[model samples]
Target chain A: MRQSTFNNKFLPYILLLPTMFILVVFLFYPAIETFRLSFFKVHPWTGATRFAGFYNFIKIFSNPEYLHSFVLSAMFAFAVIGLGLFFSLLIAILLNQKIAGIRFYRTFLIWPYALSPAIAGALFNFLFNPANGVLCYFTGYRSWLTDGRTAILVVIIAAVWKNLGYNVIFYLTALRNVPQAALESASIDGAGAIKRFFYITFAFLSPTSFFLFVMNTTYAYFATFGLIDVLTEGGPAGSTRILIYHLYKDFFVHSKTGYAAAESLVLFTLVVGITFLQFQTSEKKVHYQ
Target chain B: MKQVKMAVMMLIITVVLPFAVFANGGVDVDESATASIEFWHAMSGERIDLIQSFVDKFVAENPNIAVDVQYTGSYNDTLNKVKSAYKAGNAPDVFHSYEIGTLGLINSGIISPLDEMADKYKKDIPWNDFFTPVQSYYKYQGSHYSMPFNSSTPLVYYNKTFFEEAGLDPENPPKTYKGIREAALKLRAAGHETPVTWNLHSWYFEEMICLQDEPFVNSDNGRGSELPTKVAFNSAAGQKVLEWWVGMEKEGLFLDVGPGWANHRAAFGSGEAAIIMSSSSDVNRLTAALAEKGWEMGTGYIPRPEGAKGGVAIGGGSLWMTNNHSNEEELAALKLISFISEDESQIAWHKGTGYFPVRKTAMDQLKKEGWFEENPNYLTAFNQLLDSPESLNTAGGLLGIFPEARELIQSAIQEMYAGKPVKKALDEAAAKANASIEEWNDIMQ
Candidate 1:
């Protein structure tokens, strides 16, 4: 490998200044502010402030509704990630075929990735609306969103559907990059198609799958705010009130700034823990090459 | 160099002049000077157009005052926007707020009481002409904090055709909870699956308590004190109401249409549900909707329990002046509010939107126009409000954390409807509401 050295070390520092400035201003500053706010009791409308150590954390942890929301968020994240990965991988494999009109199918498969989450939520809400929805027509006009279990299921389905196209795009690229020579050798050795896929193609796709696992986990944990807001607004006995939705209710709806800030920090910690766990577990399974 | 210096000076003057004018309060009380003001509201769709027409008329009549009307999404969104804007010291001169948000807004120290302005125009504005319940709802600490712009009360809407088919009298719809249950049974016997439906909102629950003359919170519904210490909705009256609702759901006579206002409206309009509890403002839309299906709709006051004696509280938004501008701008904003409160504008607003006319003269004008004769159902809410007893309960609750309290009550109601024990749910909701109230009082105090 050739080593290229810069004549002016200060040139590199000057070049990095804009990016560093942006990161500090936008990301780090707000994060530090949120941490600072978590320890204070602040009035939402009046801008009054009082420092109280661990009071917000105590309040949220002691509240049963907050605890329920935490459990519900975990359930929601798992359901979304599981269903999203399974369906997208299935669709990706199908789209990777050498059939005619393959390009058309691939383009169509990735189309929903371009839709905003709120629009997707609204679309599903209309389709599954209890009174005269297209799906309700087949189910004897049953109201789907009024039932707690069914409402959560509907929300989960909407979340998964909104994210499916994104996962399929990543999986498609991963599937194409799988070494064809290895699969060809396996085929020549009289290995079954499914076996070869599991041994060779699937192994090659593990790294992409691991990356998507983190992405989808974060997406489900945080990015579904618009979807839940539009579709349910965390209702039907708070069955669909995940952590983020609960945090929003406290922050924007109830205007409990300090409590909401505390809740946000808790959620941030949870996401960090989950990401750390995923990386630790993926060390053995994810392929480097 | 001279030309460049001139250009720079011109640019600085152009940019800084407006800021200076704005900083100087953006209004002049001189007879011929224009007092430009911003009016933020939550009106949308046809209501927005109606409000716009009124704004145009106000400007045309008062050439020295220029009013800019802007829609700020729903009531909740409007409150959020106003709070943030007030914190930033740039709130609109006037804005529309829901009655429940009055205490929160007042505590923010950004509200200008309207009593002084009302006193100034007492003769021309017909202050006494405003409905008692509507006017009293906007008053906090014995002074008016907002102008009651659009007021409404819940009413029972039923399908006359279904009532007749079920062998029930359409002219005498259910007047009590037991009566509704009986009617629901008959409707179901006549092949209606879901006979009763209501929008999943705590507003209806609040009305239920008010009908029993029960305070939703302590300290005379937070009117006697600035900060409410606790909620009082978990009393026997509340428990009785929730138990009846749960029983109706268990018996399959009630349908849960979820929290969307449109869903319950669709259930009733599509003839799937024989009866629904909804706001008086839904009169025009419901009539138009059912008219397409050739269904006759009937309206009645919200039903009471077997022996309850109170009536429903008013539910809707009010106009408030923010303390963000100069005296001239405040006076101009007050002028616009007074103009809208007059009989002409109130009559037009009531006719255009199904919201009730806050002024008695507007109601009388509406009656004179044969509006009641054409739409007799619209008279039900007006009569209910007129007949309601003058008590603290009917005045409605005022809490700093009312929005959160409402959500808690709604969730508890949903839990009860889903087969949870009514008392357990109500108690849990009340506890949560009290905690929120304490938190709000802690901060505000």
Candidate 2:
């Protein structure tokens, strides 16, 4: 790439102004304020604030419910990612074949990606309602959603189903880019299809997998807020209550603004830590052409 | 550099466009001889059309006032929207909030108390004519904070035909916890899969506390000079209520349909449940639902313990006037609300939806016309309140954190159902509620 010189020295700075302005106004400002407010106590409705350094953090950390939600969210993210990636990759490889009506099938399969989480939650809620749910009637377990033990599985299924389209799109593109020559040459050495997929195709798709891992992790953490809120409101003995749902209840429903802000900080730190770890692992494992 | 700027602009659009689309674009009101007031409500379904019709009549009556009525979502959504809108200085002239929000709104310092506004406007609103329970429930610190709109108490609805088949008198419905349990078992034994169910709610628990003639929280059920410091529902009355409830669930006599107002209704309508406890406001819908199956439905007082002394506390929303409006706008808003509380409006509202009339004159008129005689189910709820002795508990607990407290109690009930001891669950709920109350009290101070 060639470096171009600006006709006017100040032109480049002027061009950067809008982006900087938005970044400060929307992102940096709230991020900084959230950090500051986490140390205070805030009234939800009144927006009144009082400085109580470390008090909010101490209260939440000591809360057993918060710890339970933390573990539940970690597990939920893991299940969503594991099931989501594996199924998407399998579907992507199938779609990579030359099948008749491929475009129609692909469009039908990928349509859920266009749906927001709220829509997915509502759809699942209608299907799993204990009274007259279609799926519950078929399954003969009306308490699929009302039972605390089974409701988490229902939520996980909804989350994975909603994200499947997004994951498949990436996987399909990555599958297409796997070197055909390497596969054919390996086949000449009597390598089975599964062996080739594990050796060459999988290695070539490592970077895409890593990118999706991070994206799915973030999605499980934040995007499922609406799903949990509409489907359960974190109910049935709080079985399906994830960390984001807890933060929403504290911030929006309960109006404990300072406590919610503290929760936000905790969530941000978790995400950042996970991303940092992902970077350290990606450098060694991810392949770049 | 040009390309980079364009890319950044695109990123900003992608990020900010959803907010822009979601931003409320309603017109801002101004003070003039033609006063335009915004009236936001939480009523949906057919009630939206009913409210609009009422507002249309009001607008016709007063040519100078133009009232804008918008149906915001549920009670929670409306309150949250009002809070954000209030902060942004776009608060509606008048808005609806559920009954439990009375203390929270009073202390928020953002609402104009209805009594003060009535006095300011010199309007002759017959506050005395409002049904006693409805009038007193919204009163805090000896002042009326909001105008009662759709007030209701939970009522027990039973399938009359099923009762007869089970060899129980259709005319005589259960009135005590023991009576209800016996009736439920008989109904189930008679081959009704589920005998009774109600949408899971803390309102029922709170009402049971009131029926036992006990305060729900300290400091006079949070109605005294000092706000509530801790909840008192972990007492014997609370335990008795939960034990009876959980026992029924265990016996499979009562259907544990879980939380929300819809599931239990559907269960009952489909004949999967023979009896359902729900808001008196549901009389119309439940009756019609049973009629669809060619069955007659009956209503009875919500069952209680044998010797409980108190009565039902009202649920449902009320209309609140917001602060920061000019005197003209406030007066116009007050006129709109007072019009809603008038006997004519109350009668129509009571008939259209089965929420009991809020005014005594409406009840008198309905009685004179033999309205209750023809539709006796409506009388069950009104009589339930009329017979209730007034006490701090029956007046409904006044706490700034009542919403959160209700949620805590609800989760506790679920915990009990899922195998935790009733006392243990209630105690845990009380402790959590007290923690929230203390934090709320601290912030208020």
Candidate 3:
């Protein structure tokens, strides 16, 4: 009986072993290896590796380009996350209404989310192209990507457009889970639409908002890399060169894998620090009940 | 039980019949019985059809051997695919490579050095008969490991429509920087929107390096070494060239454009831009696309600053042998290489594409056939490359990691085009790039 009980308890782990093993091999292993390589200098041509302590990190801070990229990354991250959440919540509230063809609206709203960032970047590039671009023809804006001020602005807009749909889906799902009784009670108390929404709906959606805040911040850091690559290629003097994009340049374009690893470690610490901050600040505000 | 036995017999026959085809390999494998070879090349578009036609003619003539051809994407993509294939132990029998830093792969025991293979096969072609100017691009450590293919150098591409409006002769393009500046002024006077469009940074700077006789990197004679402690691109010649470019920008004589040189070609084709500087290989594509637009096109050698020495540096890529295959497989690959390098095949490549021939004998044969008479546009690029004296620094450049160096140069150039001081931007880029070089050298040591 005891043997059977023990087997039953261990069977779940046995079934999960393959998945756990794969995750470790593909994800955790590379992460650990990258972390270890952060202390090395790599030969660009021969791909030979050697330990160099924190020289790469030191170099990262000292190099003006690297510093610029880090600042750009922070700016890109916050701007994307803030705009993505704001627009998604607004769209979600509008779509939550009992309108005609709600199903059609849902499908249409989520369509852009299905297109990959690389494709989105390409399409946006064509639209933003100074010459022969549709946007330039209509708006009379020349060299949108070549100008530093306009380049970052266009990148942020592209990010928000590409990302708002996914966040809307999350917001709509959270809104659906909101209790009808509470809303009705608030309405009976003569609460205005804005007041009810602010007190009831907003409070209820906090958990979802928090989840998306973390997720969007992460996505802004990593997933937007492909967008930058295809759109601006971190160009117009590296104005749009975010941290992950810089990491890509270091690893592939520069073939400085070790230096890239060091940059990646710095990025990892930044992300972790922000996430910890989010958790600490939000613990009191999150109302599970 | 009796029916089951009959069914089993039918199944066996069904499976065994297909084995007959399998025994012969696939139908596309081209069984000529003399050890069939697979040749993977990155040639695409019209170049694809040209290569296929050549292979077809070769197969028709050399019935004893078969040549299989496949198209991969850009040069970098081709190199990556080859590397992965080598790692996976299933590399192609023959593949195209670049004259870039890929020679390191050969030195690192990833590619079979062609000299040893030549001795073993006793099939060495006369090295002296190859184009002398194109010879340096195909070597590593004093030995040839590749055959130069689709070799090119940047040239000045002008719009005849703009030239006519500016009252300049269509036949004579600029041969000196003074002439180019004068042409730019004339075009602006004639009210052309964009008088010039060029791949601002690379073609502008690298052409100057070749024109002024300076090497971009040092030690393996610019085949990419770690010995250069500094980027000398900030030298007088480099600065002078950069200043000229900046002056053009200031005068609105040229505009910065790209998805690299190809985009510039497209802009020139669309009539949005007048003159463009690009590769000879692109002439076929440009002419094909733009000729029907009724805008006449003119070509010229890259114009130099007054009294500049040396010639334009070589552009385009080469096909290298990798060490991932067995001796027999490499031999099969060499046979395919030999087949492509023949005089007849080279003419087909040249006529079908505007790229220069890599072998001298092929050029001589093509000249005899009056190819230049038929295609007048080929003369400009051909004469420019042939007449230009080859220099170590002028012929080609080597850097520790050429792709990285290209990125640094490109990034800095982008900054300069955006109106940063050329010297300051270049100096900053040089420092960063040198640091990368030092890092590379340390690891290599």
Candidate 4:
């Protein structure tokens, strides 16, 4: 009995040993090293390393550019996610109608997510070209990348466009999963289309909407990083400077690996804190009945 | 369970034994016939074709030796790849590096010291024949780390049509700071919306450094034991340059045509902008692209303020050998480097890439062959940079952590362009740059 118990207790760990080893090799070790390095100042170009005590972090916090990058990152995340959810929800409701070509509409809505972000950024760069861009033709604006206010809008538009399809698919699936009987019962009670959706359909889709809120927030902050890096490079004048862009510049461009690590850790913490806060605030409002 | 354990052990043994055997077998591999060297470089465009042809000829001539060349993205990307590969114990035998910040690589022992090899090959290399400024950019702590590869000097490229339209002499481009402003005003009057496009920010500032006779950093851009300290770019000369840019902005003549040389060149090439400051290496490609467009282009030496030093630094990359190789592999790599530095190879590279020849012998050959008479733009960089034979700044600054320093300078410039107070941007950049240099100094200590 003892032998069987011992075998049973150790077997799970034995089964998990490979995954643990892989994680240690790839993720855990790098994270630990990055944490250690955040306490040091080193020249990235020369590979010469030395220990520093919180100086890198202190410098990161003290620098105005780094601070600006953090604020911009948060703003970009919310703007992209909020705008994306609002539009995707609207599209979901429209497609939910028994309109002709409804199946075709759903497929078309999910198509943008199939393309790579790099390709998307490149295409948008061409479209926003000052001299010969399609948008430039309409707006009569030269040098779209440099204009401060418009540059931010351009990045948000690209972010929203790239993510619209994925959110639509998510919301559409949730809308379909909502109990038809609940929606029908509301309509049978002399409720109009708009009334039925707000009262019955919205409550049923709340869980999925909440789940998408968390997901869209994460995607907006992280996945759009490479797109921005390739596109404007946070430039014209850093009008579009974001957190991941700052981290990349600090690490690869500036060669301040330690400072970059500290910035990344702080960014990760902020993301986690915000996510937890969102969960705490919204968990009570979501209904499962 | 026993069978599974045995099979797992067998798999582990199978995986480990071959690597051990391969390591042991390396000593017995063929050495006398010829050692094949793997060289990774970042040169692309027409230059890639030029290098491929040269390597093909070299392989045909020296059947015993074979060279495998790989394209490794931009200079910055190549630097990162090489450094990471070195740490992982898998660097290529040879790679490309630039002058300014790469000296840090040598100091950190990522690259092999080429002082002894340079001495041994000094006569063959015609080291004295190389322009002194170009050579200065490659040496670290009085020791050369790599052969001078594609070398260029910063110069002015102007649209001839715009100059003519502005009632300015197309033959005479700006030769002084006052002249540039006057010409810009004329171009603006001629209906060019943006009269001046100052791309390659370093070129304009490096010229300003020369004009001011001010240093790029503390202790002569890190030539001595002094730390980099703060960036000195916000000096009177730097502010003057920034004010000049701001003045142009006010006049509606200044435009940021993207951050890179290619973008600015494209803007001007496409007729959106009038003048751009760039390396002479841009001439051939620009000429070829503009040839079909039927627009005349003009080339001139970079303008300087009156009574300012006028020598420009070299701006292209060099071939650096990594320490992650055997002695034999390094020697083979050196042979390839030596081959590329020969007259025929250098001339081919010059004609192909618009980069000036690094050797007097190659230049002499090209001159005799009528390359200059046929393509005068190719000679502009050589003539302007080699004008002074003994100037230290002419050789280019070799800061310990040069790329980072450039980044600091770029960030400061970006801030200034973004409308930050010039003084504040420069001061902040200087402080941050000093912190980085101090960190590098600490590591060296």
* Candidate number achieving the greatest DockQ relative to the actual structure: 1
**Please, what are the lDDT tens digits per residue for candidate 4 over residues B265-328?**
7677777777777778888777766666888888888877676764776777788777756645
TM-score of each candidate structure, all chains considered together: 0.92, 0.92, 0.88, 0.88
* Per-residue C-alpha lDDT of model 2 across residues B164-209, encoded as one tens digit per residue: 9999889999999999998988898899876888888999888888
Model 4 per-residue lDDT tens digits across residues A55-150: 888888988878888788888988998899999999988888898898998888888898888888878877875544678768877667666677
Off by over 4 Å in 2: A1-25, B1-32
Cα-based RMSD of candidate 2: 13.1
Candidate 1 residue lDDT tens string, A131-220: 556787787756577788888999999899888889999999999999889999999999998999899989999998899989998999
**Sliding window of 10 residues with minimal summed lDDT for model 1 chain B:** B116-125
* TM-score for the A chain of candidate 1: 0.95
**Model 3 chain B lowest lDDT segment of ten:** B24-33
Model 2 lDDT per residue over A146-251, tens place: 7888889989999999999999999999999998999999999999989999998999999899999999999999999888877787888889899999998887
DockQ of the candidate models in sequence:
0.53, 0.42, 0.27, 0.22
Could you tell me the C-alpha RMSD of candidate 3 in Å?
Answer: 11.6
Best by TM-score: 2
lDDT of 3 at B16: 81
Clashing pairs in 2: none
lDDT of each: 0.87, 0.88, 0.76, 0.75
